[model samples]
Target: MKKTVILGTLLLGLALGGNAQTKTPVGSIGKNDPKAKAILDGVSTKLKSLKSLVANFVLKVEGGNSKVTDSQKGTVYVKGQKYKVLMGDREIISDNKTSWTYSKDVNEVQINNVDQSGQSMTPAKLFTNFYDKDYLYRLIGETTEKGKVLQNIELTPVDKSKNIFKAQVDVDKKAQTIVRMKIFEKNGNKMSYEISSIQPNATVADAMFTFDAKKYPGVEVVDLR
Candidate 1:
């Protein structure tokens, strides 16, 4: 269960970074807010034009009774339906059909089938139109960060039973890219990710999304499929 939760969280973050090209229709939650749709549409348009992307990010987690804060840095590479993510001593590689999660600390790798449900969250759906379904979103306000204008948008899950209560995204107006995102969980945990750098249309080979077991000596392989 712990691994499942961790994988779910990581996949959610990847989904947020995924791509969407079509215009998202206003859902019930955001039907009254045209401004939010407009801003999100702009982001979608920008993401649709990119063939691939590489981003360096900082993740921060806060909350819980101890109020302890933790921070980590990671990198993500996305090309169409494929992605590779590295964080700490762990790496996730997926070719949109199969996924391999390797943990250097444990010297193990887990293989699993890709989830393709209608409600599935994956890297390929991140920036695209994933937001159009599960959550109700609206433009909250705007702010300036490092001289760049940012539009802040808040999203609330239509299903109250979701572990995530709300999410806040800060989109860079000029670049039409997401610079930051904060997710608030029902369990009182708050997680935030800031994109420190981004390279759009990066050249990434397909092999980069597959795990080669021979490269890792004596690593245990767990097949969960």
Candidate 2:
């Protein structure tokens, strides 16, 4: 379940940000597919224009047999580099500098400094520009559902050693929003998330991204930094 929360955070970040910068060159593994670029650009433009966003999502984890082993629902709020996520008994709050991960089941909160190097899978990088660096993207296909057309794009990592084998992103062409993302892992596990609903340019307060320990009277705070 910890993995699920971590992946959920990545998806939320990726869904809300745009404009990527990469330290390492994309090299030969990356492709210049115009069709895929156009679709991704549209989604990126739409997300970047939003001042803030609130989204409800459904996450499903599938086993090697292609059976869904676990399913959960969650909510995420994003404003700039800050985000707050709630999934089951866990809540992760980040203000782009510090992060607080609270687990209700354990009655503990873990505090740590945020990763800003842009090399790691931090929420800021994923939301802003992580795709620009290590990914080679191509347009896979297109489909329609509920009268909405969606363009599907597949992204493969430039580094073969990465645990994420491939990432499939579905964008709603008309809405210019990401509707779903499916991540295929090297371990034969599949994780997918669907955006059920979203409110763009939401009025979110900065304090929402910070964890107030005073609210949790008896919770243990573990400062890992």
Candidate 3:
């Protein structure tokens, strides 16, 4: 369940890579700002134009009562509906049919059916148009970070019952892509995922998104499907 929590935190940030947990259907939160919509549309267009994508990111988990902060560097390979996320000792792989969650520390892999119920945000939808129905977004303006102009967009989930109440996405103005994402949860936790590097139209194989037990010696498979 710790892995699920981490994945939800990761994917929810990426989905807001525009943002996951399941909740009631959203009602109209407010009118979507035209400026924000156009910026997000550009990101969607840029993503759809790619054949495959490889991105290196850093996820920084902070807040809570603890004074310490945990940071993990991860790589994500996405091709169509398939994706493989490698973060720390855990790897989350899905082929749009079956999902695999592998934890290296335990040397075990958990398999489950990929739920395409549109209730949760999958990796494939990370760079797509998921914000349209889920949240109301507004452009919060722009700032220059190390010479790169960044556009900031604030998103509020229409479904109040969701764990995450708000999210902020920082876009690279010239590239029209998400550079960083920060989410504020109802539990007083703040998570930030910053894209360190991105490769559009990267060369990636389909095999990367599936769990091959043979690759790991003495591994245990737990199929929950």
Candidate 3, residues 1-225, lDDT tens digits: the string is 145545543432332322112122333447888888899999888888888988888877777763327888888888997888999999999999999999999999999998878667766776678899988988876767677777778888888888888888878889888887887778877777777788889999988988899999999999999
- What is the lDDT of every predicted structure here? 0.73, 0.73, 0.77
Candidate 2 residue pairs in clash (backbone atoms < 3 Å) = 13-127, 20-129
Q: Between which residue pairs do clashes occur in model 3?
A: 14-17, 15-19, 16-19
Q: For model 1, what is the alpha-carbon lDDT of residue 11?
A: 22
Off by over 4 Å in 2: 1-5, 8-29, 122-126
Q: Give model 2's clash tally.
A: 2
Task: Identify the runs in model 3 with alpha carbons over 4 angstroms from their true place.
Answer: 1-29, 65-68
Worst 10 residues of 2 by lDDT: 13-22
- How do the residues 3-87 of candidate 1 rate in per-residue lDDT, one tens digit apiece? 3333323322211323322343444543536787788888878877889888888777778663538778888888887888888
Stretches > 4 Å off in candidate 1? 1-32, 65-68
Worst 10 residues of 3 by lDDT: 15-24
In Å, residue 183's CA in model 1 sits off its true spot by: 0.4
* Candidate of highest lDDT: 3
TM-score per prediction, in order, is 0.85, 0.87, 0.87
